[model samples]
Target: MKSMKSVVPHLSFCVFLLCGNCLAAPPSPEALDACMRGWADQNLFSGTVLAAQDGQVLLHNAYGMADYNAPIANTCDTRFRIGSLTKGFTALAVLQLEEQGRLRTSDRLATVMPDYPHADTITLDMLLNHRSGIVDHTTLPDFQTVRRTSPCALARTIETFQSLPLDFTPGTQFKYSNSNYILLGHIIESVTRKPYADVIQRQILEPLGMHGTGFEYYRRPIPNMALDHTLENGSIRRAQDRVMQNAHASGALYSTAHDLYLWDRAFRTGRLVKEKMRQKILSCDAEYRYGWATTEMFDRKILAHSGETEGFCSTIIRFVDDDACLIVLSNLEGCSMGRIIQSLSALLFDRPYQLPKKAPTGPQASADYGAYVGRYQIKPGFFIDVTTQDGQLYRQATGQSRLQLHPESKDTFFVTEADARITFEYGGEGQVARLVLHQGNRDFPGDRL
Candidate 1:
């Protein structure tokens, strides 16, 4: 067994066949915990979840190991890096500064940073709501390369894309961009003449007594902090450390699931800012507010956000109308976070929720593997190369680690790396012609290329 040779011991799973059917569901909330534990026992899940209603704590628990090396188990208080969820903190700080009459939302970026391109036309309002027309630095190939190697500096990072043209007219359309929040972080610094971290600490974290949350520093050790993990080539490994400056104000924050609940509670009680300002932040005029995406779930107005970085993923959903909140934080990336959040919300409302089941596996035919082994275009410029080695199949995305695919049926396959499934569509002649990758609630199709 590979377990003998690898640092991470091979996982052992009980075959709870549930009568030979992979899915045995309509699980109660308690059963949901068992289902989640089942995934963890299979070496599939690692994280914490907190669900509450009307200021009442209903469910709070953690699963899997925080540091697989130290073998530290995750707890409700274990801190995890929360990718873009930091945007909410960033946006709140800006709005708080506005409430203090320190800055106005209509202020032009050019007024504060003269060198920024189109600063005259882009307003603070635009940056807060992701209508600034700035290109997402996170998606740029060069930025991605540089970030992994070194700590990104604010000035140097902003200058990298200052001269570039806008993706659209300012405020004319909505486009999510990391550059927007990075710039907002800088603006916070400029207005207060303090480090963004210090300002955030003073404004939000300190005020709420959220001692468990703060900025992430790679070299600085955090007690009870879960080591981030990433899936690479069908194996789980420590997530690569990047310069904290790379994520900076945009995504560098870390917090526990419970602390995030305090965050949500702050809004509920109007403790974060004045009611009028808070209302502005919660407005759904444009499908998004300062740091939240506005949407309807179970016919209730919900403000939510999800975060994803190299080794971490997180989500926070606030049912504004129902006075309820659901938060999930993870050290592992792409662990089916979206579906899990949705299912938890449903269970809370007495809606039907099917428990997660193991993706079934079956024997492959003589030519079964060969027909699906080929390169397919995931997007115009992205491709997934499917290859087999030692009679086992694996898939690699562009610039990403490969994962093995387990067959549930003849044409369908799934992977535990992220609850992702793939299926090849057959043509009239029977050879595969197109592929579909399904995870959570989204699907991406790829034509054989």
Candidate 2:
């Protein structure tokens, strides 16, 4: 044989050629570290983050405080209520049951829960893919008050939305409904003859060694659990608490970034389910599949999901083909998670990314302040009221607390609490006509009423 060094070099070149764009170099940990540190210093993020490639961790760190009142710092092991990220676990449990021949995806809802209205027309697959047309229970009129006051069992939760008419014929359209997953949770319990939480603990968490993950309940003392916070009126405050059981299988799980990393790795290594079943979980026949959303970013396929509750928001993104993943678990609600995700992903792929910038302070007083004060209708029953107090501008959405708007330019202002900007547009007479809200890479124009 030729020299071993020459052979190694040839093998490496062939591997690169075979893998094509999938073989690009992984992002530097230092770069990711610097980006996160900048965000934390700007108070843009709190909680933990983990990034990994090819089963090896590149950056695993925590930032800000776990409990702002106690001034306790967060660690890598800090657990966070992951909101809708719990759906992924619920989905996986369903798939595992299928693998065990407990139930088939094609089974009709009537076959499982015969009493549900229109059950005969809906299939389990429809629920899995969010094509079931079931109304989202969380959108019901009493959801906020009821969820905060009491814990509703799955059956009682089902009663909240069961009688509501379907939004569309099952399997003809896709509509994301927490009710679908809640029903799946009930099915899991019914078929296994065990509580949904127990099934998850025994089948998934224990086997994957994810000891830090579990369902959350009200007032449960979980060690190192981060207290949820929300940005309000340009200040950080504790978020309003909700009864976790109300979230049910839809969004009640809490976990750490490290444990979530293990969750991602299990999917990659086929440790959770066989390869065929894994593909089924990740299938993109619809925009939503088995609790994850399938999409592409930077020309690479991505399986991602995000969760938001009263005081917490979380995200997990997996570049399945490249074996790379990013997990962000945050306690502060209403923060710009999209901006953070996009920036981190850009750094990961060597694309252009920007660091957080300090909010600008414009003049102490401006004559235009009075002109900008008015209510603009964004849509039906939704309005944004702009007002000035003590020479500072503020914007308040319908039913939300007023947030101070920092002047970025003569007619444009930014909110320090979120990655959002507002621009005032004037009509021919120099009168304010419309305003535009720029956030999360989208623009919403609100006409002056």
Off by over 4 Å in 2: 1-26, 361-367, 399-401, 440-443
TM-scores for every candidate against the unseen true structure? 0.87, 0.91
- Model 2, residue pairs in steric clash: none
Q: State the lDDT of candidate 2 residue by residue for 1-449, as single tens digits.
A: 00000000111111111123323233888878887887788777898989887788888999988988989998998999887888889889989998999998889999889999999999999998888999988777777667555777778889999999999999999777888988999999999999888999999899988989998876778888999898776568898877776677887788999889888888888898898888786665457788788777778888888887777888899987888899988888766676677667777876665555566645557766889999999999999999999877899999777888878887998886665789999999989999999865567899998
Give me the runs in candidate 1 sitting further than 4 Å from their true place: 1-32, 232-234, 359-367, 397-400, 418-420, 428-430, 436-446
- Report, for every candidate in turn, its global Cα lDDT versus the true structure: 0.76, 0.80
TM-score for candidate 1, please give it.
0.87
- Tell me the tens digit of each residue's lDDT in model 1 across 6-44: 100111111111233334344245755765676566566
